[model samples]
Target: MKIKSFEIFDYESAVTFWKSIEGVTLNESDTKGSISSFLFRNPGLSFVAKDNNEIVGTILCGHNGRAAQIYHLAVSNSHRGQGLGKELVDLSLSKLVEANIPRCNIFVYSNNCVGNKFWLKNGWDDPTTWKVLQKQLDV
Candidate 1:
């Protein structure tokens, strides 16, 4: 398998991959156009892992010019034990570091047991003192 930076052409395959994952949440905000816009705004911070040109894993990394965040990190069921997730994280974080980003954060759904476990196992701390409250806004 090969790991590389995400490209526009990989968008459909990445979306398909995410849809197959058990805990991934997809909504109107994840449309092709929105994803394309995100890629345009945060070049080089996202990645995909491929096996013979088929997308197998993906990670979307970005920042708000203050803090870095990682989203949609998933590995195909067939490729989970081989460290693709770690590689994706390392590569994206390297890019952030190059851009002088001080820290990176990831959010896992409360009901996504495997995902939560994966993050904790990979050294991501979950602070009990903090809550991830969000307010949906209209555009």
Candidate 2:
């Protein structure tokens, strides 16, 4: 397995895989919007994983001038538990370090028990570092 930056040619396939994730709540609009912005504005941190010829995972890492964040880390269902997630994180963080950046953050969906535990077990948790909030929209 290897992680590399995504190509726009992958848009259709990536969106198909992403939208099928059970708890990810992603749609084409979200991917199109966030991904296009990231591509033009912050290309370095975004990545994808390939298992030989297939794209099995993707991650989008971001950095402000002061801190870094990893978002939208997803592995295709068949490829889970093979350590691809950890590999992706390590790769992304390495890029951040090369840029002379420190202090990183990642948003794991609160309801995703597997992701929460994985981060905790990896010693990536700092309780005081992040706070979660929700803003209800008038629908």
Candidate 3:
């Protein structure tokens, strides 16, 4: 499999891959329009792993000026253990470094044991000093 920068045209395959991943969350905010906007804003930070024209893995990354954030890091069931996830993350981190972003973070659901384990195994430390909070806003 080859890792490549994500393109707007990969949306369908990416969405299908995300749907197949057990821990991936596809919310109302993750529509095609939202994804297009996100890609427009954070070009070259996200990536996809493709094998024989099929998207086998994906990682969405972007920075918020001060800190970088990773979203929807996933690998196909048949493609796990191949280090694709780490490769994608490393690529994103390199991009962040080039942009002078100081740090990076990813949100993992408490129930996503697999994701949590992957993050920890990849040397990501969880900060116990802070809590994550969010509120829905009406637009």
State the local distance difference test value for candidate 3. 0.92
Tell me the lDDT of candidate 2. 0.77
Q: After superposition, how far is residue 16 of candidate 3 from its true place, in Å?
A: 0.9
Worst 10 residues of 2 by lDDT: 22-31
After superposition, the stretches of candidate 2 with alpha carbons farther than 4 Å from their true spots are 27-29, 126-130, 134-139
Clashing pairs in 2: none
Against the true structure, whose lDDT is highest? 3
Task: Give a tens-digit lDDT track for model 1, residues 1-139.
Answer: 8988888889888888999998888877688888888889899999999999888899999988889999899999999978888999999999999999998989888999989988999899998998888877685
The C-alpha stretches of model 3 lying farther than 4 A from their native spots are none
Error of 2 at 107 (Å): 1.3
Q: Give per-residue CA lDDT, model 2, range 53-121, as digits (tens).
A: 677888877787688888777888898888888888888888899888888988777798877887897
Per-residue lDDT tens digits for candidate 3, residues 28-126, read: 668888888888899999999999999999999988899989999999989999898899999999999999999999999989999999999999998
Worst 10 residues of 3 by lDDT: 27-36
TM-score-better candidate, 1 vs 2:
1
Top-scoring candidate (TM-score) = 3
Ranking by lDDT: 3, 1, 2
Order of candidates by TM-score, top first? 3, 1, 2
Model 1 alpha-carbon miss at residue 39, Å = 1.0
Lowest summed-lDDT stretch of 10 residues in model 1?
130-139
